[model samples]
Target: MTGRVRGALAAAAGALGFLTRVPVGRDGDAWAAFTAAPAAAVVPGYVVGALAAVVVAAPLAVASDLPVASVAFAYVLAVYALVGVNNLDGVADCGDAMVVHGDRDRRREVLADTTTGVGALAAVSLVVAGLALGAVAVAGTAPFVAVAVVLAAEVGARVGLAALAAFGSAPHDGLGSAITEGAGVGTAVLALALAGPAVAWPLLAAGSTLAGAASGAVAVAAAGAFAGALAGTAVVGAWATRRLGGPNGDVFGAATEVARVLGLHAGVLAWTLS
Candidate 1:
């Protein structure tokens, strides 16, 4: 393979290792490559989304009578199991920062504080509940539709992270800076391009499984969900930029969690309306 190809492969491996509990090996070289190629972050979304989709859909497929609630519970568990609670730490940190009535520096200090506050408790609770509720709605859909929605949401969440990395500047030297320092508009475009297949595959599946109108609705739902995820993350990024000076590792994590939940709801709502 060419040097570029090898570099891209290593970057992708690094992304998977850093982002998920998947057994990809990690190293200094891989981490450096991943930071340099921000687009590589989008690649892992497909793998993570697929695995999570299967976890959500497999039970329904095997036992058609399985309760939707049970499936939803599994979906939530599968997400945490795959991605771990590291990102959720961001949610807690950001949550604490959000409630602080102080200057940006004070909020930033709160972001770095290890002490758990009521804000953290509330934020984490809401996110977890939102995720579960969204999964319940998705689980109520047709199996193919459910799978498509789950996949789209997961992938969209990662796309949100890539967007922040590509477009936002870090306020300080940390994880956010490490990823965003080398990124720019080009990185954002490439990340979006990498995410296209995740969206397209769902539309194609919808077309195969439903009649024209229904398929079109699914198409809308999937697209809406993806867009919703990006939009949700954008809101978080903008808010963080204003409130905390710029995006940080905590902001990125919070964005991911928020985007996934919003995306899931947006897809379900679109499908319901259609």
Candidate 2:
């Protein structure tokens, strides 16, 4: 395949993995014989998420006889069915294990073992439902602002996952790191190179959403939440690298989900305040 075709193929596979339960193979080599551009491949996943939001949100905005608010909520309701819970699971696994109980060692163990704790269940279930409802409410009440809010959260989480994925292991390279390694430095540069300008318009629109918030409290809340979202992934990644000394595919998957859910809620709550 041509270079761009390879890239697009890689991106689409990663997106399929991101949005569904299917696994992203080592090196994302399912398509390529060897691992191919894992980190850069994540761009496709972000594209998919952004597309998913637009697909679900736009139609709901137009056709529903329900109040705009109700229509907004429906978008979130679809999200929970589509992509939200996956993140919630990651959050609960990270939370119940690391945030609530257990040291780094124990948390890693808990995270890996095929077992579920009450905390994990509660955390994921609650966050999924709450975020969906909150998103719905925000979309209904706030409309364009809420769109920016969720989009930022979605885009931020995916990008954050790619950045964190760069730190991986040897024989056990991270799902992100391994697949990323396939793409090469030049590919990564190209992937991110166009991102800034592409999102410029959205950023402007997002800025408009945050404009009225003009409050220190709202800023603090949003900032704090954004920090919190990163903590879950960074902490887990660090712990895996430091203690266990490497990140596994599960950890990578866990990080992606955790980051996405946390960003959504944090954005929603922050926007709600203003």
Candidate 3:
């Protein structure tokens, strides 16, 4: 029992480590083990996300009675701001690079520079605002559930990028490679499975609300939404591949953030309108 508990805890640490650069230093001595423990990283990232949810949701719940929708939006803002905001930065950078310029070098420059440009400013603000509004509108009953969808998508994106970094590695050295070395196709698939529900369940609930169990039609809607989620990730991944010839830490961060929000929004919106 103790061993099982420890194993779970380690995996959680690994997950957290995978999300942030903290795990690499923490597990510095065990280079081989840390690099091979991909599932471990997922655990920590999820835990961190869950903790952020409590902090964000608790205050909104206590301070005032908000509509589920409002709280849902707040939760997203809080979660992103608290620990996952790095990914938000990625989205903003990607947007700025993709929109304001054409050349690959310029795009990479936009991504690498920590400075904010007009394009980056607009993209980040708009996205964060949309996420906050979406959550607030439907936060009443399923705020946490919605957040899970986001985090799950985050993990999925991470898993995919993990595979990308591992295989598409250039003559570079960074933490991204370390994570890729640790991850496997199995881990990536599991991440996708975890991410899949974020869209499907809320979709079913929303459909049930409006249609009262006509799931056949719900299946169609769910499939479309899921496809959109995939498309978002693919777009980002392709850009990263072309732009850098391989993903760097920045690209990885950007992809994860974009996919997570896209997944959450896609799921919640499907349910909200269903």
Candidate 4:
């Protein structure tokens, strides 16, 4: 391969290695090389991961003997397995940090504490419950729609993560800082562009149905959901900046989890209302 091709390959591998637990081999030293590439390149890794989720969920979704809850639980497990539990740890830290009544320093201290508090407990509960409920709702839908919505929601979640990284300031010279520090608006825009089709796929699926006027409504809902996913990310990023002094790895994790749930609900609501 040419040098440029080699770099692209390495960056892609870096993205998978960094974002996921999947082994991509250590030949290229992906963890270190990952930081060298623009974070936007990692977006594709999210797409790949989301696609895997869809594939895994499809069989369960179409199976007559399977329960929706089982499918949802499996889907959630598959995603967490692929993505790693590191972000969930962030949710716990962010929760504790948010509930602590103090300035940024105090919150940061709480975030760094290894012990889980009531706040952390509540945060994990809410996040896990939300994810399960959202997955169940999507799984209850038609196979095509279920796959589309799940795919879109996962993609939107990653886009939200990238947006948070791009728009929010880093609290310190930590992982969040390293990832988000130099990310520009262009990176966010690129993430949205990649996410757009995934978000819109449900609409296309809905439109292809013979439901007439309801088709239009589903399309509109899909659009609204997509817009909401993006808007919610910005709002959360700003909130984290104000409340915590800036975004951290925890905040990014929280934002991504929030975005996925929002996207899933938006898609389901659109389908229901239509």
Model 3 C-alpha lDDT per residue in residues 139-251, reported as the tens digit of each score: 44343443444444444444555445445453246765766655667655655555455335545454353323244334433443444445556777787777656666666
Deviation of model 2 at 205, angstroms: 7.8
lDDT of 2 by residue, 126-197 (tens): 655655664554454333344444554555455445555455552244444555455445543544453343
Give candidate 4's TM-score: 0.85
The TM-scores of all predictions, comma-separated, are: 0.95, 0.64, 0.66, 0.85
What would the per-residue lDDT of candidate 4 be over residues 60-134, giving only the tens digit for each residue? 545746787877888788878777778788889988988999898899999989999999999888988987898
Q: Report model 1's TM-score to 2 decimal places.
A: 0.95
Assess each prediction's global lDDT (C-alpha) against the native.
0.85, 0.52, 0.55, 0.70
Each prediction's total of clashing residue pairs, residues at least 3 apart in sequence or on different chains, is 0, 10, 24, 0
* Candidate 2 segments whose C-alpha is farther than 4 A from its true place: 18-35, 41-47, 55-73, 84-89, 99-105, 168-194, 203-246, 265-274
Residue 273, model 1: lDDT of 87
CA deviation > 4 Å runs, candidate 1: 205-207, 210-213
Residue 171 miss distance in model 1 (angstroms): 0.7
> By the lDDT metric, which is better: model 1 or model 4?
1
**Predicted structure 2: lDDT:** 0.52
